[model samples]
Target: MSNQPPLAAADLQKTQQGNQVARTPEQTLVGFMNQPAMKSQLAAALPRHMTADRMIRIVTTEIRKTPALAQCDQSSFIGAVVQCSQLGLEPGGALGHAYLLPFGNGRAKSGQSNVQLIIGYRGMIDLARRSGQIVSLSARVVRAGDEFSFEYGLEENLIHRPGENEDAEITHVYAVARLKDGGTQFEVMTTGQVNKVKAQSKASGNGPWVTHWEEMAKKTVIRRLFKYLPVSIEMQKAVVLDEKAESDIDQDNASVLSAEYSVLDNAPGE
Candidate 1:
């Protein structure tokens, strides 16, 4: 064995402290997760395997990508991060299993923003898996004689083969979701609806709905089916879209306050 001097105890402690510091998440809006008001809820919402620092890092990175999210209320943003963690989702991934969309700031008189929490297709699957609710999920394109149909099923037919129909149009896309005890649910979207959604998404600048047409179609049906499926409270919170359309309430409140201020300014003997 080669003879070498061991590192000093003080130096070793310093190195350990540095590593701990490096692992700590930087203080940002997400840092509010550790505050007493949020800490317990975050702990309950987060998966046992996830730590607060990791959750903050994942959400913080997402905020960097979509700068608008920075304007989101800190409490609401942290709640969204906790919801994402509960769903076992990483916001930094390309699929963006969860998103925190800010609304009402650029035009609202209150100048306050609310965060809309929306979950991706993968997040849906992950949430279903955790609850042991999903038995299997799949979709495929199949040709039956002269017509091409998207045949979706649980375990049997997830792949398409060239057994028939040398030439045909893919007329529809179907999605199958099999639940643990409940029977399978089949949802379909015709090519007409597909084109309509495509056009709408394009008009609104949603490139993914056009680029990943097939995947988006499948997700569309699955999200629809979620209306009938019972989900855990955490899952429900993660996927619910915050309704900015209801900003009318905020606007009305602002108007009422403005009227009161006008009356005060126009007093009879000012």
Candidate 2:
């Protein structure tokens, strides 16, 4: 038998009090937000069909396409900027938007940008259409701080809807990331959501995409890697069992008739 005292209230109190979970106070406060409610509030507060990941991807994609970003051989501008967000995707408001972390040669860190990227709502939509994501970027800065706010949303010209004109507090997105391959390659390991509307109706349906190659879009980077055009994708709805697990029957032999004609005998006689 052990001599240690039973876990008493004093012991439990000491353990509970001594525990210090590692998270910044700001991080803790941000973590405390009610995510679902925040999503709704953000949706009500911001433009339609916009999210942070979508924003980041679109801007980086645009930069990658530009001649300056493309000439990224440890020369020129070494590739594009990556967008990151402290406020993760809840699909609404400032929290839903991603901050542009300009990557490559221009920034101190991997995706850190000396110049800002402001993506207007219309520009965001355009970027989405071309790059399969929704985010516009601008180099315009609204404030100066280490953790500065960087947000460019709902370009004033594109506010066709009444709610868009409402005084939605726009915020800036800021973060840092890295570039690779003379700035030829950039990666965003993320899961994201996109809204698709009926061709006729403007109503939205948020389609979610997992961050793997299995789910795909044509002309997306993965599609370009395929050697063959019109490659087939098999969607399996049912499973096939291993039917021939073991051989069911033994082999049978057919009878052979042998005559053994004397061709050699004729040669000997000759």
Candidate 3:
């Protein structure tokens, strides 16, 4: 055996102390989170009172619970995670109800498959609330004269409960964003817009558009109305996603290209 020097009592004591200092779970997680790749992955603002370590744990658990998330590309998966964290939305079918749809080959651009990120209506409201862009918002189907119209704003107190509002016969959906700066923006989707959105949804292979037509209409109105509102960075990312989706749809329509997956709804944190 080759010996450089004998260990002194101080060295031995220091070694013992170092060995005794076990890493906490959080600390260990932070070590992994400090990796340059991980730092780059988490480019969005984390939720209140949540650290990068905590977000990693949460997102990892979500990806584990939802196998669909595993099909996403690393970058897209990380983007979804970042969006969820920014929106304070729980993953894996939890509170925020975020879901990822991976489109293989169909919508891919530059040899990259498309991954669509979506959040529930509740998440949309939460994001808007967090941004303080809107004071209050609601949408409902109402009977106005001979036509069925969706009313939204301070005047509309009732939220159309989908199936429950069957008697009202929704012909249009309206979305109103009451600004914190003391003005209101409104968007209305006519039946024609609804049909167009439904056709787009069907063409995109999103789902049976008939079942989700109302939701899609409401979302269209909300998506359009929020475009002019002062939104957060998370919202800006969502807007970019929307614009890209629109471009994809336009390309599909004009050039006979079909997108198997379509980015749906306003982003979770937007």
Worst lDDT window (10 residues) for model 1? 256-265
The better candidate by TM-score, 1 or 2, is 1
A best-first ranking of the candidates according to their lDDT comes to 3, 1, 2
Q: Give the TM-score of candidate 2.
A: 0.17
Residue pair clashes in candidate 3: none
Model 1: per-residue lDDT, tens digit, 1-270? 111221222332343453444432223343444444444555565677776566666676777767666665544455456545555676644764545555556333225565545445555555555555656655443334533334454554433354565456655666666766767666666767756655543112333343455555555555665555655554454334311111222211211111110000111211
lDDT of 3 at 172: 67
Compared with the true structure, what per-residue lDDT tens digits does model 3 show for residues 68-164?
A: 4454444444444555555555544455434444555534333444445554444555556555545666543333334433456677532433444
TM-score quality measure for candidate 1? 0.57
- Work out the TM-score per prediction: 0.57, 0.17, 0.56
Sort by TM-score, best first: what order? 1, 3, 2
Clashes of each: 0, 21, 0
Per-candidate Cα lDDT values, in order, are 0.48, 0.22, 0.49
lDDT of 3: 0.49
**Candidate 1: segments with Cα more than 4 A from true spot:** 1-40, 86-88, 104-113, 139-147, 150-171, 179-183, 191-214, 228-270
